[model samples]
Target: MKTALCIGGTRFVGRHTVEELLAHDYDVTTFTRGIHDDPFADRAGVSHIPGDRTDRDALESAAAEVAPSVVIDFCAYHPREVKTATEVFVDARYVYVSSGSAYARPDVPMRENGTPIHDCTPEQATDDSAESYGPRKAEGDRAVAVAAVEGVEAMAVRPMLVYGPHDYTERFAYWVGRVAEYDRVLVPGDGGSLLHRSYVEDVARALRIVAEEGEPGEAYNVADRNAFSLSESLELVADALDTEVDVVGASERELAAVGLEPADFPLYTPRPMLVSTEKLASLGWESTPKADAVAATATAHVENGRDGAENGPARKDEEKVLEAMEETSA
Candidate 1:
């Protein structure tokens, strides 16, 4: 059996990727801070090492003790985090879960070679702002890409706006919940913009496949092959719930007046975040059906009691915006 060490394997993508690994019969060890409870702690084939990735000594000690054949990281945000990890696990094949935001100002379907990447050192930012987050992540991926070690392979798997069950972000769930709660919905910008999102389980599977079959020094974008427009996305969510809601298009200024920023809402981008998955498909990886993923998310919203129509504190603001939008259009 192949020995796998998963850094930060107790959370959303980490947990799901571990499950996928276990299903493949890989001998797995999970590394976490012992803060969040691990749902799979009792699974017979799994083991755990308690430590913080930010703590170089703690992570180095774990890496030496585990001596895994493969290392998949889930919580490497800073380049320092991945740089230390690469140094410690120099002999292991590495797979880092990077984000699509690493692409610099992508306006079309972002291919592995498609866009100008955010080639920045994290130290340049000095602060973790919205602008810095992508560059920081890009630096982390670059850390693995430029490793000087011989006979070692590392690849970056970039996923765009991952969503599914246990999504604490509540961005996508907010939309599903909105459809369940109200008859009319305030959609921004006529719903013509494209949003690329990957289901958690699908991304998890892609990580496993890439780890097994991906080429070293390569990066793959793990996302749905087809890009869904905002309108198509909302329709899929509503169809999964078997309901129809009126969609009112609102301008950003109008939404801002009611305290709803487009950035605050889920999948609210004006630019197309399309990604070409040709590299991933070339590896013979298959993702779950988009409809199945959508249905599962819609079902999760209802079953998890997260299907509230309003965005908690922003509920009144949303309603006010809707009422004012109606008044203006009438």
Candidate 2:
């Protein structure tokens, strides 16, 4: 059996990637920091190696012990981080989980191009500023390309707006909670904004596909096939929950009064975001239906009890927005 090593495999997308790898009958070994509990480690074909990835000796020791055939890195954020992982897995096929925000003008369905370089530097990439996330990711992506280990090469998987079970961001769950708890939901502007998102399952499936069959040294954008508008996708969620929500298009001013910003609302892109998956598809990549994915996400959110301050605006805050709208209409 082929052994696969996943760094940071106990959390959201990382956890799902491990699940995908295990489902494929690969002997899966997860490397983590021992900060959380993982139910997967209890399974028949899974193992856990807990330690700080920043610790080079520990990382090298574990790599030698596992001797993995494939390594999927889910936690490296900059070139320094990438260098550390690549040094350890120089002989194995690699998958570096990169971000779509690495593009400067990710306002569109970005293809694998270099125009978005908005000036990439080692300094900008190494910093931890909110502004540095994308640039830092770009630097990391570059590192993966240059570090191309001998024999089997690495494939960079860039995913956009990942959401599903174990989503600590609570972006998608916020909408799921709104549909479940409130009849009148407040949305940004007209809520016709379009954006791209990669479901956790979809991303995991693509990662496995690339690991097994993808071309080396090639970067692929792993995103959903369709560009969905906020209102349109929410309708699918509403249908899933058997609930009708009177969607209100609140101006930014109204949201600001309620302490909400444009970014605070999930899926708040002003334009269409249609990321190209042609490269990934050429390697046999497929996706779950967008409608089905959205419905399943809503169901998972409600069942997982993700409704709280962590998800997004609290119910009380939403209720206050409703009150304001009601007062305006009255």
State how far residue 131 of model 1 sits from its true place (Å).
2.8
Q: What is the lDDT of candidate 2?
A: 0.81
lDDT of residue 161 for candidate 2: 89
Which regions in candidate 1 have their CA more than 4 angstroms from the true location?
148-150, 253-261, 307-313, 328-330
The local lDDT score (0 to 100) that residue 71 gets in candidate 1 is 90
TM-score of each: 0.91, 0.92
**What lDDT score goes with residue 81 in model 1?**
79
Query: How big is the RMSD of model 1?
Result: 2.3
| lDDT of each residue in 275-294, candidate 1, tens digit only | 88889989998777878888
The best candidate in terms of TM-score? 2
lDDT of each: 0.81, 0.81
Candidate 2 has what TM-score? 0.92
Score residue 306 of candidate 2 by CA lDDT. Answer: 82
Candidate 1 colliding pairs: 109-274
